[model samples]
Target: MVYLDNNATTRLDDAVLQAMLPFLKDEYGNASSTQHRMGRKANEAIQKARIQIAQSLSASDPSEIFFTSGATEAINWALKGVAERYTSLGNHIITSQTEHPAVLQTCAQLQKRGFEITYLPVGRDGLINLEDLKSSIAEKTILVCLMAANNETGVINPIADVANICQERNVLFLCDATQYIGKTDTVNLQNIPIDLLCVSAHKFHGPKGIGALYIRRKRQPIQLETMIAGGQQEKGFRGGTYSVHNIVGMGEAIAHSAETDWRSIANKRDYLEQELAEKLKHVAINGEQHDRLCNTSSITIKHVLSSELMSQIPDIAISSGSACATGTRDPSHVLLAMGLSPDDAKCTIRISLSKYTTDGEIEQTIEAIVAAVHKIRSNSPTWMLFEKGLLD
Candidate 1:
């Protein structure tokens, strides 16, 4: 299958697999157990992986990084950690309507338990208004959780500006950077006054179930209450035996992404869009093209139902929106919040490329999409009426 669903998850790198084989087979020791040579090796590997992840994010120290099951867990840790630790300061949190379900659902759960959450709306271009953010911050607001890049639309948020506002207000800033890393180099971490940042390794070609959270050393580290209580696994904040193989794989993936040249990937993504746009009409790009990730495109066809057409092109793997909502058939909340109608929302599909994607594969996917859109539009009664000028 032609895998254009890099946002959903990535195929594991062969190098990552090779790096992890020893841990899965012979070096199977719990990281917490430091008595034996095997245990020491496992513990050392975990520490090394932590440093690799830390370096990738330009983090000051490895101790400031917390490993988790994935970005979802990291997000939960950040939100609940700050809320519980600083409960006396305030109980209100702010985030955007375009965040992943991981961030949105966690905030929703917090609301059920008496916490106040303000969901900031995005513009038609999928950008959160900075002025709206300033107005939304109340004296009671304790934290703001905004994603660095949108998972569905691939739009990059103005995180540095948001961080500046948060800094001046003395409110904590948390950025979910899962979709941004690997696709683009992050803004200097030292310059941004964010308190916490989260990333998933699998999104960048690592094994599933491994991710990291970066806590700024300059800020009063969020004193989040632990979601899991056990032995002091992650410095008493999170408790569980670390996965040796997964952690190593995550480190390998981060190292690979950081070292590779990204300009080529950006060029390929541009080529895919130019070729597809040339071959098809009545298609709209979903987000601001200039501000989006070089490896992702969210496209909407005037009359195409996303799943129906996507099903016809079995070789090209893509999505209707976020990977978490791919099979739901629900209209994208991200698009709806951006003012797209339910019909337009259903017509949207996302194509996420990676460094591994090939030019030939992009051409094939474009050919298939061109044909599928034509097929769907030809059968659509709405298109018939609109073409005949019977309906505006």
Candidate 2:
């Protein structure tokens, strides 16, 4: 099957699997134990993986990185941990309407606890207005939570600008970098003044159920209330036994991503979009005018349902929206936030690529999409009327 849903999860790299094997087979020991050689070896491996992750993100201190099950858990830890800790300073949080449900739902939970949440709106291009963000920061605002890149549209937000604004305001900046980490140059994070960042390994050719959160230690370290309380793992911030094999896989995957040729991947993504546009009329490229991720293309075919189109091309693995929101029947909240009508949102499909994606796969995906869209639209009376200039 031609897989074009890398944003949801990528295929694990061979190197990553290779790195994980030794840990899974022989080096199985609790990283929390330090009395025995086996436990010491596991602990040493975890520390090495932590350093690899820290260096990949240009973090000066390895201790600042905290491992979690995935971006969702990291996001929860970042948002809830800050809100609980800083309640004496402020009770207000700022975020965008197009954030992943991880952020949005956490904000909702905060609102239940009487913490005010300001959800800034996004434009048609799925980018939030920095001005709106600046004006929303009141004296009670303690955190500004924003995503670095959108999962569905792949639109990169002006995170550096948002970080600057938050820094100037003295409010903590939390960036959900799950979609941005391996796809782009996140190494410049050292200079960005962001306080907290979240990333998932599965988004970058690593194993699922493993991710990291970067907490800037040099910047007047903001203390977070511990979410899980038991062991001293992750500097007592998170409490759990480390998944040694998964951590090793994450480290190897990120190391491999650093050497990948992203420009070629971008070119393949562009070619697929170009082919789709040339072959299909009434095709709208979502967030086309904005700076987006190199590997994603969110397309909307007029009068065609994305589910129906995907059903027609069953061999091509794609997503109508985010994998997290797959079972929900509602239109994509990200598209809805970007001013797309429910019908337009329902008709949208997100095609994301990875380094493993090939030119042959892109060509096959384009042909399948064009054929599927044509077949679906041909049966639509709305498409017929629009084609004949009788409907707008």
Candidate 3:
């Protein structure tokens, strides 16, 4: 199948799998144990992986990286941990309405407990207004959580600007950078001034269930109260034995992506969009066209159900939104936040690519999409209106 769902997750790279094999077999030992050679080896491997991940993000200190199950868990730790640690400072937090469910759901839970949350709305192009953010900030605002790139539309937010504003105001900035990392070259943490950042390995050709959160270190040393308290693991911030194999695979994946040129991948993706869009008259590009990940394109076809049409292309795999919620009827909250009507949101399809995708695959995908669209529209009365010249 021609997989176009890189935004959801990726097939783990061969190198990543190779790196993980030793850890899963003979190197299997609890990194927490230091009494034996086997344990020491595991400990060293984990530390090496940590440094690799930190270096990939341009983090100065490896200790600032905290491994977690994935971006969702990291986001949870950032929001809840900071909120609890800085409760004496304030009870208000700021975020965008288009944030992932992990951030929004956590914010909802906090709101239930009386912590005020200000959800800033975005424009029709999926951009949060900086002026709106300035207006939302108050003395009680202690934290601001925003995503670097949206999962569904792949629109990259102005995170550096947001981070700078939050830094000037002394409000902690938490960014979900999961969808942006390996797909682009914007991982420089220095430019962003982010206090906390989240990234998932699976989104970038690494194994699932492995990710990291970068916590900035300063004189104040951003202290977060432990949520998963137990065995004093992960500097006592997170408690549990580390998944050595998954971490090794993640490190290998990031290392490879860092060395590879992403512009080529971007060109291939753009070619696919250009080729298909030239033939599809009812097509509309969703989100901000320029301020997006190079490997992603979210498009809307008028009067078409994206999921239903995509299923007709048996050789192609695509999506309507986040794979987590693909089977649901509820419209994408991300698209809705960008002022899209429910119908518009439901008719949208997300095509994501990776460096491994080939030119031939892209061409095949375009043909598949064209066929699918034709089949679906032929039976659609809404499509008939346009053909009958009744819809201008």
Clashing pairs in 3: none
Reference-based TM-score of each model: 0.97, 0.98, 0.97
Candidate 2 Cα deviation (angstroms), residue 99? 0.3
Where does the lowest 10-residue lDDT sum fall in candidate 3? Answer: 281-290
Q: lDDT score, residue 70, model 2?
A: 89
Global local distance difference test of model 3: 0.88
**If the candidates were sorted by their lDDT against the true structure, best first, what order would they fall in?**
2, 3, 1
| TM-score of predicted structure 2 | 0.98
Model 3 stretches astray by more than 4 angstroms:
389-392
The Cα error of candidate 2 at residue 348, in Å, is: 0.5
* Segments of candidate 2 deviating more than 4 angstroms: none
**Candidate 2 at residue 155, lDDT?**
97
The true-versus-predicted C-alpha distance at residue 32 of model 2, in Å, is 1.8
What lDDT would each prediction earn against the true structure?
Answer: 0.88, 0.90, 0.88
lDDT of 1 by residue, 1-392 (tens): 89999899988988999999999999999888999889999999999999988787777788888899999999998998888888898999999999999999999999998999999998888998999999999999999999999988889999999999999998999999999987888546877777899989999889999998888877445677886898899888788888999999999899888765578777877787777778877678888544888788888887678888888898889999997875686799999999998998898889898888988888889889888878877888988987888864
Please give, for residues 46-97, the per-residue lDDT of candidate 3 as tens digits. 9999999998998989998999999999999999998888889999999999
Identify the superior model by lDDT, candidate 1 or candidate 3.
Answer: 3
Instruction: Report the error of model 3 at residue 49, Å.
Output: 0.7
Best by lDDT: 2
Clashes of 2: 0
